[model samples]
Target chain A: MNDARRHHDMGGLEAGAIDRGEHDKAPWEKRVDALMVLLGQRKILCVDELRRGIEELGADAYERYGYYERWMASMTNILLEKKIIEVGELGARMAEIESGRREALR
Target chain B: MSRHEHTGGPAHAHGHDGYDADPTHRHPPRPDLEDTPLAYHQVMQMAVVSLLVEKGVVSADDMRAQIERMDALTPARGARLVARAWVDGGFRERLLADSKAAAAELGIDLGPIPILVMENTPETHNLVVCTLCSCYPRFLLGLPPDWYKSRSYRSRAVREPRRVLAEFGTDLDPDSRIRVHDSTADMRYMILPMRPAGTEGMSEEALARLVTRDSLIGVAVPRAG
Candidate 1:
């Protein structure tokens, strides 16, 4: 199915016009917009990983299609705003989770 | 249904398929680790670094110090970003459309590497494997989980993603489409899996509980039900 149809079928997403002022908007609002696309099957993604994957596919030349570092920074900011993962919490959590799993297996 | 689907060619060999059968104890040679294979500028940088070190232009102490600092660094910021993306749709969309913009929004930046987003759809599942090396989204997901960085996972994910997923308990039919994503470029990718059930009205923290680092890298499916 086409992107538009797939989007609509999944759930109507209000991917409003690409507003530059999105920079000033709250992270949660931006998240809502992104989620709409995912639910709509717009293929939620990470631009850096996508480029890396493409590059791995032997498209080193094609990898330079866009400015990746800049996009990663921007996308990261959006995710941070939602507090989905705390800035400094990953390390502790990893330790706790791993330790628990190890204990469980033992 | 057999989860292993034959896409085109038969799957490539894994790193440890016959590791025990080596008559000689020679390790495999490392692949080229140059930042850019054909870039003249990098060639010049390597030449300069070599020349400088030969002439004591830049002290080995300085180099060692820099390496030490880098080694002590943790990738928590990137992990935070991945967890956040798992919960927020707008950010996820922005991440897919433009990763740099998304990263900037979070105040973390990757100077030169371009970021890319690949989603895992029901029809087209995405699995990430570092066939050549252990390249991963360290910043977003912290250190790579043991399973993800394992030789078995790297080899199995690419050659037999359906079987691998089933091993991880994500059963998919053989006919169900599969796309293996390799994190080998200057760009990085994170999986946007289908949200699990029992998460209605759950807070981001709760949602994060379900976002395993492996799932973010597309190795394992998010737990649902």
Candidate 2:
């Protein structure tokens, strides 16, 4: 982690190959993108807050996820921080969905 | 009783969710979860949006409208502007003077983000990068390509612009200075690449076809064919 510059700062760092292939956006990714724009347009959250949330993601998660994944994580964290949704509720809902998927698989 | 296995073998005989019996059983890598159709982060995003809707933070209609608005924008708008500027010197002057107004004249809505048109001359080549983040003129050019947001492009574009441009197959004169614009502020930048040689009589519409998205981003120039 280059602490001298912020985590989001990527200027002048050595990085790997640039994948130029264009892939279609997944459905969930599209919805998440729209949700972010809607939230911004409605004044529910600002771009700066979103950027800060993304920047605050620990080094591990930051390097692990893709661009949209980071955005989704940042938006989720911001919502949780603002008390829009409780952590327990979010976790329970996720678990419920996971079990539902397991049931479908079985 | 490992967290991972349930067959009741010696791995599960101790009944501690199988993890304790095998200290080597590390948590599944996180990237695997993202490969699934509905990634965990996507689910979390859905949950957050659902809760926000239920709490009256934003309506479903608002989201739909925003999605529609984004869908309506594409790089063709930028192509049209570049093509027009190429055929008309006066329009090019106006475009460089006030990009927003020029875009408006060409029926392109640039949204709230201010756009600055950086012309690429023989003496100076222009490249755009948001060193702080992936900030491009989305209103006109649409969402940036994956490489534009990559850590490599963002970092290398500003540090060694000529080398970066070379990677994109855009080799410039060694003596021509390269100006890398780090779009760290509210304003977004677009490169107005010089028109390629030949086809002097080509229509503006025909010329627009040569203006690839990469050219608008300054990674490559508009090719003539």
Candidate 3:
């Protein structure tokens, strides 16, 4: 197999039948979309940068994560690389939100 | 494996029957209502929004407004263009020549990327796909559907579009040619399907009602009402 194609370069392959059933979009997904739009609108990150981040996600994670999940990962990575949002602050915020969510559920 | 189940034999149960045609639906319940813990991405999304708003890079109000602007857009915008092209050949020529200006005439801003319009005639049908990730004409046709972003479609659209179209219940004539347009980040595409016969004398608004999102994607053709 002398294949040189990248993981996300699935232009033509033996992929199976398409799933026609449309799933209900989650609110989080819309927020992720809005985040991208805002980021783009502010000239903080371009769509090309997002595409590159997605391409860098390797085969397994690319296949595993949902569409917007991959988008979140890529955007976060780009923001981190750009120094727009530091990893420590982001992790701390996520942990705080997680605990608050757990408290509410409990 | 496959991402979604192949609910075959279709007039497109999910959307085209009413979605792209009518542009109205209910979204799923918010994740907060669910008893399970927040997903990793959901947490990240919240954190990202909070950080952006706190840092003044973008306001929460502006974020909401941006989403609303996108939410307000629908396939009707593209349908109106298709219907206008159906009734006027001059408009069609202008559309195929410069889609952005044509869409602008209709008060639709197609954004920075150039979205090319491919007209479908009796001899040829055009299909749109984004193999290298979903590079769709979002501002023109609203958000790309899940199936449009599916790995199966991304892979097969350029390879076996005829079979894929058949899955959408669009069986083309044996002699008719099918052209697949793979959209990139720099350029986007949408199919201007042939006007169904016997649609004469109908107002443009009435004709626009017949254009489905699937048809605009070249998987199906609008039917005469």
Candidate 4:
């Protein structure tokens, strides 16, 4: 189905209880949000393009991810689509960062 | 009835046996990443930002300035606007007519996105939601609350708006019509909730204190002092 009819089309659906809890903004989430806005201001990407990238996330990821997590994933996809970064390079850098984080935790 | 007819769209034709049922549908996992499932995506975001800086797509200062700008905004600006609108009838007319210009009159630059002010009246209550994604009036109200972005709120707001409003502790009269505005496009929305009674002589500053962030989102009403 097209975007207009996808699962994200939640305008009128039966849903469970609303969780009104507020969480402190995580540092990484803030950075990602700022980065996306910065990129948009520079005309490197537009809001519609970003929205499209977000909507393109497959059904499972869309359901499982948090708001900023979805933003991060969409930004990554947009950068890759625009050829600002290669897929292989992104994977390698992500692996390096992940390993570094694990080391610090240990 | 056909599956499409039952679900109201072709998207749900696959029913429960679709995407989630596929054994290989998982995103490639990174064991070294933070233990939470979301951690991998966060790391990938950092990687993307690093690559953008390295490639000279945007400068470090640009990122810093953007972050600072976002940090500087708060819902206090929106609260002040609502308070001013309550006290001055002419200003309230302007706010209802042209929200962006009215916001500018009070020194709030709403950026490029058009903001429409929805007035909550006795006969009709207003609620805002972005069912597609969490589109909000960020320029006026700062970042939206977490629950505003939750799937439950997004989905249920349009289907059962009265129930949702009641959950927010905003019990409307049974006869009051509920108008749910979905921010699907470029235009963002903010609610100018009806000013509470018993605050007739209250100063605008004092009235501003009564406007909560949830009230601006139309989930609740400004409290009486």
* TM-score of chain A, every prediction, order shown: 0.26, 0.87, 0.95, 0.89
Candidate scoring better on TM-score of 1 and 3: 3
Extract clashing residue pairs from model 4.
none
Tell how far residue A2 is off in model 1, in angstroms.
Answer: 42
Which model scores highest in TM-score?
Answer: 3
Which candidate should be chosen as best, given DockQ against the real structure? 3
lDDT of prediction 4: 0.80
| Model 1 chain A poorest 10 in a row by lDDT | A16-25
- What residue runs in model 4 are displaced by over 4 Å at the alpha carbon? A1-4, B1-38
Candidate 3 ranges beyond 4 A from true positions: A1-3, B1-35
lDDT of 2 by residue, A36-66 (tens): 8887877777888988888898666666776
lDDT of candidates 1 onward, in order: 0.47, 0.77, 0.84, 0.80
As for lDDT, the candidate ahead, 1 or 4, is: 4
Model 2 TM? 0.85
Interface RMSD of each: 22.4, 8.0, 4.1, 8.8
Model 4: how far is B55 from its true place, Å? 1.4
lDDT of 2 by residue, B79-198 (tens): 999999999999999999999899889878888988999999999899999888788999988778767887778878888888788888889999999888899989999889999999
lDDT per residue (tens digit) for residues B83-104 in model 1: 5676788898887788778878
The better candidate by TM-score, 1 or 4, is 4
Tell me which of candidates 1 and 2 scores higher on lDDT. Answer: 2
For residues B1-225, write the lDDT of model 3, one tens digit per residue: 433112111222233212332224443222232345667878898998899889999898997798788888788989999999988898899999999898888888888888899989899999999999998888878888889999999999999999999999999998999899988668888899999999889999999999999999999999898
Ranking by lDDT: 3, 4, 2, 1
Evaluation by DockQ, superior candidate among 2 and 4: 2
